[model samples]
Target chain A: MPVEKLIFYAFAALMLFAAVRVISVRNSVQAVLFLVLTFFCAAVLWMLAEAEFLAITLVLVYVGAVMVLFLFVVMMLDVDYAAMREGFARLLPFGIIVSLMFFGVLFYILRDRFFGPENLPPPPPHGADYSNVEALGEVLYTEYFYPFEIAAVLLLVAMVAAISLTFRGRQQRKGQQVSRQLQAQKSDRLKIVTMASESPRKATPEPAPTDPEEGQS
Target chain B: MDALLAVLLIIGKILLILIPLILAVAYTTFAERKLIGYMQMRIGPNRVGIRGWLQPIADVIKLLLKEIVIPSGASKGLFVIAPILFIAPSFAAWAVVPFDAGVVLADVNVGLLYLLAMTSIGVYGVIIAGWASNSKYAFLGSLRSAAQIISYEIAMGFALVAVLMAGGSMNLGEIVEAQSGGIWHWFFLPLLPILVVYWVSGVAETNRAPFDLPEGESEIVAGFHVEYAGMAFALFFLAEYANMILISVLTALFFFGGWLNPLQGIPGLETITAWIPGTIWLLLKAGFFLFLMIWLRATFPRYRYDQVMRLGWKIFIPVTLVWLFVLTLMIKGGLPPWFGEAG
Candidate 1:
């Protein structure tokens, strides 16, 4: 077998195994890690298929940023395994139905009529100088510009929504104003009052008549 | 046999890169110590060898000989894997780092992106180590480190985007070639703000001071690696140092014109310095940045956690974004001398 073929097979096998493990793992952290592995394997598969730009972007965006945040939240959560498992049996049938429906839809879309080799032959391979980034950028900027812009705007909106949802108004919180602190001058913090130096006073002897009444008492 | 020869040849090239890189990392530690020591009016580790030249070697041997102690309740598999996971990406990122003109392991078109991805993946090691250790200090340290890394990554990415816009290519070699004329033609002159953001973010990303709040000794003991000992702990140290060197090298490559002679445009100096190798120039540039890293460590106090976050998210990100906008305008308007031909 060709080296590429071998690599593809290995990554494919790993992806499948990781995907299975993601569902099967009891530990939330481990499950998230398995999912990450699955994504990584998928990215490698994409690389093998000569989609280097997409492959790296997938790793960069999903595995690097999104999944790190996912793992962060999952790791921090104090999950009750017993409570989580309680509804598994009750939800199994519903889950099976939903997944089956989803699979059926995918099958309908990806059936031989639409996606077979006869209908859609593989793309011709480009030369060594061919840049996936440039090609993708050309198409994205020219052909699908409006859609791309719309998607970007949608993401912006989502980001804004998330922030706004979480943002509490600045209640009378004592937050550090770093700029103000940095701009502070010596005079603002310390005032050196210039005064005449006080002369040391010698201890005076008490007069005998000052406490005459007390002594008499 | 031909295929086998090719594989061996590739392996040889990798070793050529890795050997020097590992040595550089080791020496960076030595340099950091000696430099910091000098700053504080003291000599560091002179007992190991002459002027402490063999200090890193001794440290390495000691670490190797020591037993890797696992905490009683620590997750065994992950505890072992975490350091490897962290160190692997730092090494892997070297694959695309060009030393001289066209001297790279894998000159992939998406080299910059690949580096970004690889570096970002390193946070997992810290997170995993923290979680597996089952120690509050470790967990808190990792969380802080990971959050810091993620925040800084955005600013770093934006800075790289500015570089990409200015250079007109993702290939590191191509980026260097674009700045061929002289130091004046380098992206650093036009993208000064971006360069500052990139270098600062790079420092933060590596968890170095003044951004080294992740390993804040006073607060979290040893941070994420609190439970780690011996070789395992050494791996984290290795990864951090390796990352520091990588960032320095990358800053050189992106801004200082990697492997390009700085005296190129100067008439007499150019001819005089012609005998000097490009790799040396690259090293010198990277070495200066490395010195700066240590210098900063010695000079500055560690940033408070909130301040570090504010600097990354509020300050650096916005700076990069504004600079990126300005760079885009410069590129579009064909601004003279630096970016006239960039469009």
Candidate 2:
């Protein structure tokens, strides 16, 4: 086998291990990290397959933005490991059966190409100078334009809905409106109050618990 | 056998790039101190070596000799890996940075995206470090860093899209080459506002001062790397400074025309400008940006956390989005001067 094939196999094995670890890991944070590893290895595989744009996008989007948020949320969650582990055995058979069934379906789809002579030959490879990004862009904008536009619209709707649902103001805590905070000029907060100077006269001569010198402050 | 030799050659090339990068980071720390010191009316780092030249080396040795104290409650594995993860992408992003014409490790077509991708990976280090530290300060710092990066990346991406639109290429080399005629032909001339947005976003993305909420020493105390000690802390320090330099280099590349002299036209001046090497021009531009960073730190007060958020999401996103739309219209309209290079 060529060195290329060796690298491919290494990536594949790493990806598989990471994917497994994603579910198998006891710690949620650990699980998410493993998932990131899975995404990273998958990106490398995509690189091997010569889909540089998609591969970089995978790293940029999934491993970068998405997983950071995932880790953020998972860390905030207070998980009871012992309680989670107690249910693991009960869920094992179901998990195994479901995964097995899914794999079986995948095998069923791929069996013809994998077992027999390659019925579907690989697509013609693009030249080194061919921009994967440009090709993908052309397809996304031209051929699948409608679906792409719809998907974009759907994401926009989801984003708006998420914001509206979660970002509404509540009366309980005096929430910091960042805009209000930022817009406030120093003049608004820092008032140079003019008053007559009194000779050591306290506003309230209440007895202090600790030090009498505190009243001067 | 040929492949083996090729791998060895590539490794050597990688080392060539990395050594300079490591040295750059070392000296950047020194420069930041000295520059800021000059601004603050204080003499900086004249002790270690001549004009504090060996301060970075001394700092490194000190950090190396210092004991790494892992917090008892901290997650061991992630704690160990966080600094490595944080620092790796800072170096890795340099692979696609075109120092001069045809001078890059991997001349991938999606070079810009590759840089973006690698830089994006920098957050993982902070997040992991914060998480593994098991300290509130670290966690808060990580969250802040993550949120800040994610929010700013959008504006930065849109700003870059404008650059791509103008340059008509995603490749860094081509982007620089496209702005070939002169400083006036540069993308920054056309996409000035977008460049500003991108620069600000870059500052925020790198977690620099005025937007350095992630490392709020007054409150969170070193932020994400709160629990890190010895070389781990050093790694984070290195990564931060590396990222600063990366941003500076990128600013030089994307907007200022990488490695290209400012004066391309106007007879008699061309002789003066042309003599300066392209690589030197690039370094000078990058250095200026680096100096600007230090200047900003000295000049501006650190922005409040919410203020930083407001600046990013509220102020910048809207500005960049509107600018992006305007550019798109210009391209469609075939407007001259406005829609010149990209359109």
Candidate 3:
């Protein structure tokens, strides 16, 4: 078999295994881990498809950041594994029927395409030394530049919205003023005032317990 | 048939080179300790062998003889596999590294990319090790390491991009050849900022001080390898040193003119002989940088985690980006003839 075919098979096998385990596993944490494995297998398949940049981005963005945050949430939550397992039989028949219907319809709709003849010719060799990253960059920046900028603006807006949502007004804590902090000077608190020396106090009064009950005791 | 036999013969030759290289890695620990000990005003491992020459061998034997202890509640399969995952890449990378002219085991076109891929794969070992141990400290250490490696890798990538721009190639041998003619022709002088950023990023990437927050001995308790014992710990140790050596070799290749004589135009030296092998020059340059790594490790304190991240992203990344643009301009205009070379 060719290397690409071999890689495809390997990734497909891993994806299948992880997908099965995602449903079969009793533990939710393990299911999430299986999901992560499925993502990883998909990434590997992307790599085998000559999408090097995409493959790495998938690993970095999804595996490195997304799955980590997922793991963090999973670890932090007080998940009731036993309770989650209950009512499974009650839900199974309906779940199976719905899943089968979805899968059957999806498969039926796509079967002709899946087993179809090679209608399209192989893409042109994309010029000598041209890479997918460069090609994508050229297309994104040239023809779709306005849309790209719009998408970026959308993302920026979303990011700001997210931050503002988290930024609540907490009155109790002391908030820092950047300008004041930066401009702080020692002279602001210091004073070299001259004063006449006073005589030391001869005696200091000591107070006893203030309550009349203490005096009676 | 002759071609096939020659290929087999070449394979045999590579194995011959590799066996000694592996042995050298073992002894590099001894060399590192002895050198560092001398620097720190102490005698290291005098009893291990005669004058401690065989200390690494003795240490290897000791580690081998020691019991492999898997902690209770640890994921046994993953825990056992982690060491192999860590060390395999360290050894595998030697295939692409050129010891001399046409002397590398594998001279693939995408050598640098292969190295990068291998290094990235190395993170899985740490992550798996941390998760398998079932200890919070180990897990936290691994997480920190994962984050550290990923963050610094970006900075490192930028630095390499500058070098790549200067050389116009990702092939390691081609990069080295482009630095030929003299030390001044090397990218380090023209691209000094990139060189500095690369070195700093390399230090962070390998988890060496003062960037070694992951394995801050006082804090994370040896980081991801906390639960590993005997041979397992040795594997992590070997991986760290191997990474250090790898980065040093890379620095030499990118900046210091790998396999090129620095003393190119010295009057009497030029007259004496020109028959010296290029690999010696490369090894010496790489060795000097390795020593510097150890010196920095001995002298510097580990940075706080936040500080490490800040330096990588907020400082190194910007500096590298600016210099990368500068380098691109210089290469486009063609730098002065004697820029990196100084007699």
Number of the top DockQ candidate = 1
Per-residue alpha-carbon lDDT of model 1 for B15-129, expressed as tens digits?
9988887887888888888889889999877998787789999998998999988898998999999999999999999999999888899988999999999999999999999
- Which candidate, 2 or 3, has the higher TM-score? 2
Q: Candidate 2's fnat?
A: 1.00
In order of appearance, the predictions have TM-scores of: 0.94, 0.91, 0.78
lDDT against the true structure, per candidate, is: 0.91, 0.89, 0.78
lDDT of 3 by residue, B179-292 (tens): 877656777888888888889888887888898877888997988889988999988988888888888888998888788778776777855647888888888989899889
- How well does each candidate reproduce the native contacts, as fnat? 0.82, 1.00, 0.00
lDDT winner between 1 and 2, please give it.
Answer: 1
- Expressed as tens digits, the lDDT of each residue in B1-343 for candidate 2 is 9999999999998999888888999898888898888888998899987878999999989999999999999999999999999999999998898888998888889988888889899999999999899999999999999999999998999898888887789999999988887777777866888989999999999999989899988989989998999999999998888899999999999999999888886678988777787999999999999999888989999898877887888889899889988888877786665356445
Q: Candidate 2, residues A1-217: lDDT per residue as tens digits?
A: 3987999999999999999998888789999999999999999999888888889999999998888888888988988888767887889899999999999999998787665557766568888799888888998999999999999999999999999999868558877776676799999889898886754556545575477576456
Please give, as one word, the docking class of candidate 2. Answer: medium
Stretches of model 3 off by over 4 angstroms after superposition: A1-11, A26-78, A83-117, A120-162, A168-217, B1-18, B105-110, B264-274, B337-343
Best by TM-score: 1
RMSD value for candidate 1: 4.5
lDDT of model 2 at residue B163?
A: 87
**lDDT sort, best first:** 1, 2, 3
The lowest-lDDT stretch of 10 consecutive residues in candidate 2 chain B is B334-343
lDDT of 1 at B28: 86
